[model samples]
Target: MMMNKEQEKLPLPLLFRQEANESLLAFCRESARDLPWRRSVTPYRVWISEIMLQQTRAEVVRRYYDRFLAELPTPRALAEASDDRLAKLWEGLGYYRRASLMKRAACVIVEKHGGELPRDYASLRALPGFGDYTAAAVASFAYGLRAAAVDGNLLRVLARLFRVEENVLSSKTAKTLREIAYRMLPDAKDGTSGGERYLYDGYAAAEWNQAMMELGAQICLPNTQPKCEKCPLSAYCIACAEGCAERLPIRESTLKRKEEARTVLRVTDGERYLLHRRAEKGLLAGLFEFPNKEGTLSEDEAKKAVEEMGFSVKSLRALAPARHVFTHLTWHLSGYEVTVPPIDRAALPEDFFAPTKEELYRDYSIPGAFGAYKP
Candidate 1:
């Protein structure tokens, strides 16, 4: 295969190749945080943790990981979980689609792979919610397979170590970095065996990818202020040697985040709060949320809107404004608390119902976007 011109210009590192791996592993051995997933490394735990960690901070995931596993301890449990149950379990973790796709993937695992995640990269990648990074992560960490999981952190580490100047977000750069990372694998030697058992030191391959990822997350960092002075690979990093460690792995985001105004309505009876199920497909698909409209509405306007939806707004008052930022949009929300006399349950819309706050917490899966208006 012909190499990209950019990759050719900035050749992969050769000096201290083994030494760098040693440094990373040594540092990780002493300093790797005792994460819940690491404590009990299994294909199921690795898959869940990788999926949760996507676009989310590690600290935030720590609290939810244990709870999720305790509730749905196996693929069969996850496969058979009701949408509301799954959503409730995944509450407060944004990106409801991850939970949904995981449910689908769990069903696939139970049906096709006998309720255990496939140990290979291709089968793992074929499952819903399992992308290249996630698949490689589970394969390497769980199964001890020699697969390279190149995430943003790993990309930063590699780009700095080799002084790569290409945009890290570009597909070509990603492919090149994956190639570099795969070459750096501890098990890498000769021919590719299309199954388990590649060709290197047997035990170290499991730690290689995790060590790289941990180094990036803890020390390599991103932006212009990575902790290079404390980095294990600093001695081998071209970016550090050339005094440009901070400027490496150049990236530029092309898309702008659109701003939107929303009025979240909290229609409640004396005991139960009204909730609406979002459409089956789209953002926050199949999740329950408070009744809401497109633009921020005034107290009178919001109450009028709620009344039009087959309810008599006995009392209406505006609550504090809140903001929720998504990948491509920011929702500047205006919320109102509306109280109504008890209405007949049969009069409500099919997609709308009133669940007590406790019931909402235990049964319905409200998205985090409506956090400010939570009853």
Candidate 2:
């Protein structure tokens, strides 16, 4: 009874999504804690969190989420925030361009929507930094419209269930998953509305989205290590039924990781840590860090770059090699803790100045990538 990969991806019973409810309900009823944004599910909180979660882990998002919510609790506050300050707030979250695009959208809301968040799809999609997925998320969660939202996690979960070997990121797979999700959305009449719709908008937008996402994030995983026995959808999963739980999501071979070398300067005199604010553009923009030159370089090249930046390179002390893997490339960092003898104040730009260790700790936001090289 050999089955090809595509053959293994046959359609399941209509109850596939319905059967997932046990896990979803378990997560919602037993495990789901009240996240800060969960308390209100306003357009503002929904929009911000959805945007923040892009390519960023949820645990990390929790930390930034609260601070960002506090700083900009309402669309008015977000609209009022300066691009420079907003970018700074989003410093370590990476994908800096999203922050800029978000600001542009906020401006639109303030000017055109009167600081009120839009409820429909088209208007929301038109906003900068928001695409189809984000627009659907906001429309459903923020406004309770039953638009299906798809992301990597969703595609992974769906592909495995259907035993789909198609490119998970392909436009076709994405469209299929979105259609399936929308089709399987709990009816409004199932809960308590007495034939009127049972699954409320809240359930569709907030609960369903969270449940599917949490399942993907927590159980139905990417690696060949998913705990099928523990997965709520195990009973209905095509992979599980066929005793091939780990192999259903047929994805193509991964592209090679692009490697880049960065030379980090942990510039410090005896007392102060020399740090620089990256330009309000490019990578690491709006974050504070020791100066670095992109691409792997020899000690001589690093020194030349540092000297060219007007900082005297006194001594280069080696540190443990630290590697950071970004989305498309891996950064192999060879850090040398350099100490520059105090330079004349006149040698630097008026905006750049020396900050002590205390000041750097108190004020500067250094990315974790270069932290090991910190002076």
Measured over all alpha carbons after superposition, the RMSD of each candidate to the real structure, in angstroms, is: 4.5, 5.6
Off by over 4 Å in 2: 1-13, 16-27, 191-205, 253-257, 277-280, 294-301
For each candidate in turn, the TM-score is 0.90, 0.83
| Candidate 2 lDDT by residue in tens digits, 14-64 | 574454654554555445555666767678888899899898887778889
> Which window of ten consecutive residues has the lowest lDDT sum in model 2?
191-200
Please, what are the lDDT tens digits per residue for candidate 1 over residues 1-375?
Answer: 113456446554475446677777777776777788888778998889999999888999999999999989999999998998888888877898899899999999999999999977889989998878988888877887777788888888899988999888888888888888876776443222222331122545567777787898889888788898888888888898998888888986777999999999999887899889889987888888899999978888898899899888899877899999988899999998899989667788899878777987778777889988897
lDDT of each: 0.82, 0.71
- Candidate with maximal TM-score: 1
lDDT of 2 at 327: 58
After superposition, candidate 1 runs with Cα above 4 Å error: 1-12, 188-201
Judge candidate 1 against the unseen true structure and give its global Cα lDDT, from 0 to 1: 0.82
